[model samples]
Target chain A: MRITLIGSGNVATHLGAAFKNAGHQIVQVYSPNLQNAALLAYHIKAEAIDDLQQINPNTEAFIISVKDDVIEGIAQQLAAHDKLILHTSGSTDISVLLKYNVKAGVFYPLQTFSRTKELNFWNVPLCLEGANENIFKIITELAQTVSNNVYPVNSAQRRVLHLAAVFACNFPNYLYSIAQGLLADNHLEFDMLKPLILETADKVQQQLPAAVQTGPAVRNDETTMNRHLEMLQNQPMLQQIYQLLSQGIIKMDKGTNGKA
Target chain B: MRITLIGSGNVATHLGAAFKNAGHQIVQVYSPNLQNAALLAYHIKAEAIDDLQQINPNTEAFIISVKDDVIEGIAQQLAAHDKLILHTSGSTDISVLLKYNVKAGVFYPLQTFSRTKELNFWNVPLCLEGANENIFKIITELAQTVSNNVYPVNSAQRRVLHLAAVFACNFPNYLYSIAQGLLADNHLEFDMLKPLILETADKVQQQLPAAVQTGPAVRNDETTMNRHLEMLQNQPMLQQIYQLLSQGIIKMDKGTNGKA
Candidate 1:
């Protein structure tokens, strides 16, 4: 299959390589920035194009891996092409591309991509959606070349997955930022918490998170909770986060909803 | 050094094994539950005692590795002895032992311990606090034999470290629980987020958490945020958490105060 990538950022860089590695021909790389386009194109042995008009009409598919807001505009620019068009966004609806293109779909790769780090593409899960049965089969084959786990999810389910990811990835990283702040303020090394962080993440694999949860709030140890709250008097936001998250955990333990 | 453990819980079990591995003698294992005491004692070749009266008076140090509330009571019960007394608690102050004995100190290991997991004791940070210089030196030597990182953290500093740990470890685990719930509700596998979770944690090592922060909140992408809020309408508690944490991240990015 021949594919053209419309962006050259982190997602584009990694996806371009994965597609190329899986024996697919990357026909072209398109980006407004010539340098970024050339950088990604050069690695994949594809031509770099800075103009939207230069997109190959003969290409099998066009993957718009740009920012969420820019995706709809790019789809409009390439509306005349009869090729299958897709965007790699978790939150954006698939219908955003329907008015602009005849055949549109989503190819959201559910993993964090950083230019500096090497990711095992096989382990990354690919969440996909398509406009029709024919396009869905094509997208599934393309996705399976790079990832072993391919999930067919609708816009609503994909939106929920993205929201859950923010909690799993973004919010926890924010808490780490707060932890780093606390340690640096007290002249302690950040590495001190590395083992604890690893262990905490590992525990969730075998058991439910709520079942394996442990801490002052989980135990309802008021003395320690009060001391932590008092210590965070200067930082009102962290204090509030501590109080709310603790309450959430306690509630989750009591609630019989999911496995938690 | 010859030591006697006053509890046979997670911390005591690990610490006792680490001490024995480091060529120190564990004189006895004491616990209210004789079964637990005998199990730990059997592994370390030590006597199991259910009564405080059976404590070995001549032991060099008594490590009261019990709950925060029980440390004071145990210290009081062993006050007649002249040996050094220590407690493995992060929130409890070093002064808890001062009212009872001649020498008192703290040996709080700054890592989450599980009875089922094998920990690399060498990497665990040992935060030591003592009542006097002599006692501090004795505890530091005992701590160094097992762990490579040992620090002299006062009670106030220790309390703050423990608080930071909750943010780094416990809070992140709670967010993971939320992530798990969202995925399970949508009929997605939790394993889908493991790679993202690992990368999020690994980013903090090379860069500060604030510097590497990503996602909709940091970008202030209102469209995605609004969509996520709508998806979470049924879960009011998760909705509140999402709003608060997203607001906190946005505020941290705006504030010039901490390293964040």
Candidate 2:
């Protein structure tokens, strides 16, 4: 299958290479920045184009792997296209592309992409949605070329998944930054906490997160929690996070125990 | 060195096994519960004892690996003996052990311990503190038997490390739980986010967490953040978390960019 990638950000760069590696031809790479477009295109053996007017009309599918906000505007520009049009976004609605293109669908991959890192697309779940059954089948077939885990997730469900990703991926990474800051302030190295962080993640693979949870919060150890709160007196943001998250964990455990 | 373990909980069991594996003789295993003592002792080829009075006076070191609150009581109980006494706790002060015994120290390992899991103690950082310089060296030597990563951290520094662990290890685990709950509510498997979570952690190893952060919060994309908050309207605890963490990330990015 021939594919044209829209955007040259982390997601687009990774997906273009992934599609190319899976025996599909990436016909063109498009980005507002010519350098980014050319770099991605060179890696994927595709033509680099800075303008939507230069996109090949004969490409089998155009993958708009841009930001969520820019997606509709790009779709409007390609409204005259007769081939399949898909945007790789989790939060945007499939209907956004319905009136703009003849064949429209969502080809959202549920994974965090880093431009320099090579991801095994096989394990990343592909959440696909379409305006119609024919488009859905075509998108699923295209998704199956790279991933074994593919689901027909609607717009609403995809939004929920995106929200969950904010908690699981985004917020936790920020927490790590906070932890690093705390350690650095104390003249300690961040690498000291790496093993603990890795093990915390690994525990979730085998046990329920609630069941595996440990610390002052879940244990209801008020002494340690108070001490931690006192330690963070100067940093209001971290103090609030520590308080709110601890309260949430306490509440979660209480709920698990069938209590108010 | 001959060591006697004064608890059969997760930390005690794992540390006892680790110490025994490092060529130290585990003289005895003591626990209030006979079954727990027996279980841990059986693994380490040590005598199982329920009573503190039955503790071997000849043991070179007594490791009190119990709950933080119980460490003081256990230290008081073992004060009559002249052998070195050490308690494994992160938050508890080394001074708590100082008054009760002539030879008191801390042998706190900075890692999450689960009794069912076998951990590589070599990688786990052992935070050591002593009542005096002689005791510090002795505890450090014993710690070096099992782990290469041993630090002479005082009470305040260790307390800070403990607080950091709560953020890096404990809170992230809770966030994973929240994400898992959200997915489970939507009939989506938690496995879908495993790769993303792993990558999020892996990224922190090489890059500063602040530099690698990506999400609506960091991007200052209020639209996606507001959408996520709306999706979590029913979950007040999660809603609070989402708001506070997103605000925190936005603040962090602003701080990084040299803005007020």
Candidate 3:
């Protein structure tokens, strides 16, 4: 498939490279910033375009991999291309694709893309949706070229998946940052917690995490909880996070429907 | 070095087996529960003891690999022997070793250990603390035999490390459970997020996490946030979590203090 990648950020840079590696030709790379576009275009043997109007008429698919908020504007700009136009987003509506005259769909790769880290795109779940059956099939084929896990998730389901990803990835990192802050404030190494983090993740593959939950909160070890709280006296927001998350853990253990 | 394992729970079971693999003679395994002691002892080709009185007097070190609350009680029980006793804990005070007249120390492996998973002991961080230089040397040597990352973390530092571990491991898993719940409620497979979770963890190893945080929260996209709140209307706690965490990310990105 001849692809035109719009947006040269982490997702575009990595996915474009993967698509190119999979023998797909990236005909053009589009970014408002020429440097960002050129960075990815250079890797994929594609021409760089700073304007959506410059998107060649021949590319099989135009992937709008820009920020979610700017996606509508880009889609409007690319509405002329009657080629398949897809946006790589988990949270936004698939209807945003309809604003463009092209065969529209979503190509949300369910993975955290970092420019520094080369990722295994094969494992990423590509949640795809399209306006028509033929378009869906095409996008699904494009997604399968890069990933083994392809799901025909509609906008609503993809939105839920995006929300869940936040809980799993973003929020967890925030908690890790807080942990780092707590350790750093006390003059400690962040590396000490790496083992624990990996084990926690590996456990999910083996067992239900709720059943295996441990700590002062799950054990209801008030003494340890009190000590931990006392230690958090310096940071009120962290204290709230610790208290709320602990309560949430306790609630989850009891099979209570708690906050997400 | 000859060693005795003084407990038969997750930590002790894994550690004893690893040491046995490292060609150390686990002279004896001690536990109040006869069956538990016997089970571990058999795995390590060592004798099982039902009481503290049976702790072999000749063992170079007895790792009190028990629960945090039990370390002091076990130390009191071992007041008879001066043999080097160390508790495998991150949070417990190193001073607990002082209760026994003999040499004492800490041999805390800074990793989450479960009897089920096969772990490479060489990757585990063994945090050591001892009453004297010779004891420290012996414990450090023993630690190096099993692990690449070993350091003499003080009691205060260990306490902070353990707290940090809760954040990195326990809290992250709790957040993962929350993700699982959210997905399950929507009849989605939690497995779909595995790549994202692994990638998120992989990011911190090489770069700062905040530099790559991408989500509706960080983007400050109120449209997605509002839709998410609606989707989570049935889950009030998750709704609050989504709101608070999104707000926190926005604050963090805005270069403002992430206060309540």
- The Cα RMSD across the true interface for model 2 is 3.1
Model 1 agreement with the true structure over A39-151: per-residue lDDT tens digits: 99999999999999888887999999999989899899888888899999998899999987569999998877777777788888899999999899999999999999898
Model 1 per-residue lDDT tens digits across residues B183-249: 8887888877877787777766666677767889998888888878888898888888989998988
Scanning candidate 1 chain B in windows of ten residues, the lowest lDDT window is B251-260
- Please provide, for model 2 over B1-260, each residue's C-alpha lDDT reduced to its tens digit, 9 standing for 90 to 100: 99999999989988998998999999999999999999999999999999998988889999998889998888888888988999899999988888775698989999998886677889898999988999999988889999989888889989989999999988898888888888888888788888778878877777777877889998899999888888878877788888988888888853432111
Relative to the true structure, how large is the alpha-carbon lDDT of every model? Answer: 0.87, 0.86, 0.81
For model 3, which pairs clash? Answer: A259-B237, A259-B238, A260-B238, B82-B102
DockQ for all models: 0.63, 0.58, 0.54
Off by over 4 Å in 2: A254-260, B253-260
DockQ computed for model 1 against the true two-chain complex using alpha carbons:
0.63
Please give, for residues B59-162, the per-residue lDDT of candidate 3 as tens digits.
87778887789889888877677677888887788787685566888888888776777878888888889888998998888888888899888888888888
Order the candidates by lDDT, highest first — what do you get?
Answer: 1, 2, 3
lDDT value, residue A54 of candidate 1: 89
